[model samples]
Target: MSSELLPPNWPAMSIAEANAALAAPGSPVQVEDTVIDGVPSKGYTNAPPNIHSILFLAAMTHPERDYIVYKDERVTYKAMLRAVEHFAATLRDKYGITKGDRVAVIMRNYPQWPVAFYAALSLGAIATPMNSWWTGEELEYGLSFAGVKAAVVDPQIFERIHEHLGDLPDLKHVIIAREPGDEHNHPSVSSMEDAIGPANSWADLADIGMPDVEIGPDDDATIMYTSGTTGKPKGALATHRAVIANMFNSLTCTARMYLRKGEAVPEPDPNVTRATLMSIPFFHATGSFAILIPTALRGDKIVTMYKWDASEALPIIERERITSIGGVPAIAWQVLEHPDRDKYDLSSIEVVSYGGAPSAPELVSTIKRRLPNAAPGNGWGMTETCATVTLNIGEDYVNRPTSAGAPPSAVELKICDPDGKEMPAGEVGELWCKSPSNCKLYWNRPDATAETFRNGWVVTGDLARLDEEGFLFLVDRAKDMLIRGGENIYSIEVESALYDHPAVMDAAVVGIPHKVLGEEVGAVVQLKPGMSVTEDELRAHVANQLAAFKVPVEIHFMDQPLPRNANGKILKKELREQFTPRG
Candidate 1:
């Protein structure tokens, strides 16, 4: 794709023209209106009924295509599918994983995570991918809430679950991924090597076949958990329709970007497969449905990271010839700002994308200055919206670096005042969106679901103003949720955990700005009179219940009662101002 072909005034030309061009007949990306969940939403007409069918079709079509690249492991489409089939059969035949059963996955960016996820879905079971960073208590809560029947987890996670086995009575099977000859290491654990063979052992599973199960778009496909103000993680239920719609939304976006730039639609790469660096945790909606599933179906290779490291990433990009990288702003910033960033052959990168963190306007210019060959991309959405509703890419992205860009054709965005009255452009209010990408509900939390998802619109907690040009400018947030290194941390969740300690009478949490991680978690607490608690003690208390990332990096002890409003709610905005250092 040559930027020379793009008219100098092409961006001066209306964005509508580019969008319309993509929607035109015979265009690589096409759109049509359809009813989903009783809402007349726009969606890709050619999308599969469910993700299982799509992955199955891709495996049958491009059996030898490289699906995943992790360190020395290169799993082809056929290999992954066969593993999925073998595991799905084991889940059903051996473990009695019937329809609607919940199967859990707890692992880093290992190949088994996808294999476990698909296998669970392949048998009509709901897949629950708990955060790999979660503690035993957090994982137990998710498992118990979703009534997880079986889980395919790594040895480290298995060690955590082992402590809670007696607590989780419904959890029958614990399939642990162990090394060769490390089988039967635990009395209750089943070796993944024994169950599914060794890593990259594709030839051994040539005889396996996909499961014969009837799945519908409306069937529950996943129960991914998201944090809220209540501290407890709520499992957000999403049907196949929602996930598949998100997958298609990604594909269409790519097709449109190439077509609008007059670049030929991307075909299967011959020298190296269309590769991406996937360091984001697979449990996130952005990682699972948005990037992982779409990349898999296209037969693109995902270069996995065992854990995020900028130095480790540089070499993978050079050796693997990774064309696309990024799932978080921190990843991009770290890579470009690395002391030895220029020492590697980073010229292979064509696109860099991230979201969930508040991006500095200067970050945009930095990307352009350093990685001139790559176009920077960022989008907005949350777990409720399947992680992408609006994306700014290419020239449009560079022009309006601060704006979140317009919603895709399949997504509709609107602003509403507190009373639910719709607001016109330029008014800052709650951002409500309607799209097939919206998940169904907050698992088991009817009150939260009713208040958030209402009348065919997901009432996003983001406060934003839409310009007359249709670009969304986020002003603030309605919910006191802060993103730290792309992971969403609800202030109330941390506060509730702090209050759990008897020594703490009142507590408040706020976001402290950080140059690298976007924001760091900070806490203010007032202990009970005559009671003593050290910062380390309270921090350890919170860590036991929540993930380590959610633990406060900084803590302050307050002697007087924390500031409060007339309604008796703690004033967090005031705390952020008082506690936050002057920039």
Candidate 2:
């Protein structure tokens, strides 16, 4: 099925051939054999050794370039470096923070978010970014779980977790950025403005020089928490090498794309300012590893928003000349379908890519039709993989819209059955990935670490199949699959069919308990604004594409967008509860 989608000369050369030239010895993204945590693995030989080193190099290469843009504020690379240096100094001298200590960063997508993150990392402290959407109790649980010594938060987050501070004995210091008018005063709390001043004034601060701390490539760098859908969230601890490997892997993918098109990779053009709309939360792996760090290292501009709004984003894309804009399919869809989108000059966009959820196949054609200048892209990854294991972009994505593309030279992917045996091509099984970008382990959870990370491979819970050409087609999450009358049903298939309907905007398929059948297929759909469809019409839509047993036995409609977690994944457990019987 996949082979017919590509031409005989398409990609110009094989993926293996392209990698040989791109990752050859002495090349920028050279690959080398290495050992990580006693497990054999492959890594990027020429990548930056640590996050601090990358920050320093970025500052040196683009001192006057705009690094961050939020509302009316713009921070240059030089100014951002000064702020990170001063903040790191304060963390070291005032708070006695050092290598291996955990410092929590809990805030929205504010410019200070990156400042706080880099500050902690620069001082060799483990930067733990907790979800800003977590409630006070959830936030407290994360702080206590990581044994955080200090936290940098915004006013809203500070208010949310203030009362719970007494429960966190390890939390010794708290720094609030952009605090509102004289609020509740705590003995351990301090103002970020007082420490680093406003973003615009950072250039005037005295440079204390980069922190004189020794950091190794394999040292612990970040502890990102997974979404706690089934139970308590677990921290996925990653090393400096793991995070930096993702940067190189991203670069390698782009280089491969150009080579596949029979074109030489373009050199870095300092005159052309590359920019992206920062829509996703920085805590998520897709936002931090895939978007933030990569763009920062390239000296590109990041335009942030307090929250994502299509109406507000349309102008930002035009005003900032955003070259890339995507976090998830829903985000890209909103911008593409916006009523006033045609009113703005969005011709600056070149790529519209998304991941972390199932996207409709029609979305690819729609993007090509709506924004003729942009190429639609998709991929598959997880928090444990530190984002981006396989990516499908440009012509490859347009041809195989449902496939998750292919992995790069530094990464290995295999499909395994329940008994841990590798599955043959075209057979559905759990997708497992091995790469230097994979997280080291789950913090404080040995059982989970042992179960998920096997010999450097992260056993992703998603069920998928690879084609002859190595294109991945996700079936469904292992736990989310429904069995009806002994027949297996993958929800994504039904949801995709529902999305084909012109009126359907978002859809999720859940299993409803039955007396005789054991379980029945059920669907919940959100229609496009001002568009309507009958339940019978939607059922017929899916029935046409799938077997009768796969059709939803019942359907429910919602006026609001589907409920999603911070990672932009649909909360199926919540949707399932609606079908439960009550006394």
Candidate 3:
């Protein structure tokens, strides 16, 4: 599909039309009100606010507040705005990165991430964030899929780009963020410092004479690639309004919870800025939408650590007085178990949100004991949902840790069986969501996109349930996959590589909980007749073909014929139950 098909001016129903549909019979309601009142109603009462308006507000209202704080470097909202203007003007003036083009940002969590993101958003260009951990082959697939023309990459990963040079011929510029002592010497790659240079080298944005690239609320803003149960990953294309609305929904949900708990919100005193201890990778939506975007829009201070180490994170959080943090379930586990956790005065941590994967109920109790004010909340959404649809707020989190909470105001969720029939309340079924916060479509995969985004809802491929009181709880995924350390691992993709091994007859991948990694991949396999394979050999075979995350942690060889049912299909559910621990 042409990128222009999902433009900013795409047809969308009015707010009134949306509200009526969401409030229609049998929809999930907010858990807070449901517990308080006898009657049921759709959770959100407000419309999804425009993100472009919020950007303008941040530029004007909190101009002087600290917007980004990397080690020894900080940029105020005013300064960041100017930086965005100059860089965006540079793109227009130098490379012609105009509306509808995709600009790729390939880096870990850093100040440059949001700078590049908002710069692209400012010019109506879509920001397609690639996983920093992705191999050259994976990066090539993503770059080609999105038709990305340019990339702003970290110097650390720039060395890996040569492997895919031939495949990415359309790629024009490589903007590398130079480190100290590196100097401007690379012949192939352009130095970003040499390009943007100290944030004030370019002409004033007003005098640049660039046309105002106007983008509507529904314009494509981000393309987040998520692993599919099928072989390849798919890029979920989210709109500008969708990304902003999800951020607002997250903030509103957090604010409401604090109010209900009788705790006064940390004043919207624009002077009281939030400092975030960011360890989550920017490739994921939780890092970009929940942590980075919200902080940038609020003119908050961000402390970014490129590598995620538990020991390093705790000290940084305490030293920075980090007030807010968001990460996967595994990250929370590390922080709670840090050796010197009690030594630090982590009292400033008001909110610690978790997403990417479901958390065990035990983690919630652990968080409460570690940080008194901290409430462990769940963020539930797929890439197609902009990584947030249902969020477990503070109050609901304190009350019901296992619940996925209520759907965001801009979102509408429904549970359906495999046959696409709506399931009754409390019955486990595939979860589907519709929202202005939802992605417009998948990039360049029409068949997959059509199957996932049906009728108006994105079929998340996750199995879940809506309780009688309207709280959503995840059961499993309709698609077979494992989430280890919050990174998604597709079973079929891994199994396909295993099946190619000369000694392997069959294989199945399943998730098993670990004390450290929230979940670990366990591979159950059967060797071909009269053939034998060592576990280490099999592991090495798959490791070469797949990324580290997709490599199985445990390998089990079965002697008897692999378990199968009538019609000769492997009964994976029985295998999962047979091997997975119950207690």
Candidate achieving the largest TM-score: 2
Question: What TM-score would every model get versus the actual structure?
Answer: 0.80, 0.97, 0.73
144: Cα error in model 1, Å: 0.4
Cα RMSD of all models vs. native, in order, equals: 10.9, 2.0, 13.5
Q: Estimate the TM-score for candidate 3.
A: 0.73
Report the Cα lDDT for residue 60, model 1: 78
Q: Clashing residue pairs, candidate 3?
A: none
Model 2 regions lying over 4 Å from their true place: 1-8, 180-183, 580-583
What would the C-alpha RMSD of candidate 2 be, to one decimal place? Answer: 2.0
Candidate 2: the clashing residue pairs are none
| Model 2 lDDT per residue over 1-583, tens place | 2455455677787778888888789778889899988998898988787887777788889989888899998998888899999989888888889999999999998888888999999888999999999999999999999999999999999989999999999999998998732356678888888778899988788877999888889999999999888899999999999988887877887788778878888988888888999888999988888888888788898999998888999999999999999987888888877778889999999989898778888888788789889988898888998887778886678678899887788898899999999999999999999999999999999999999999999999999999887778998999999998899999998988998898887899999998778889999998877788999999998889999999998899988778989888899988998896321
lDDT minimum window of 10 residues, candidate 3: 30-39
Candidate 3, number of clashes: 0
Instruction: Give Cα distance to truth, residue 254, candidate 2, Å.
Output: 1.7
What is the overall TM-score of model 2 with all chains considered together? 0.97
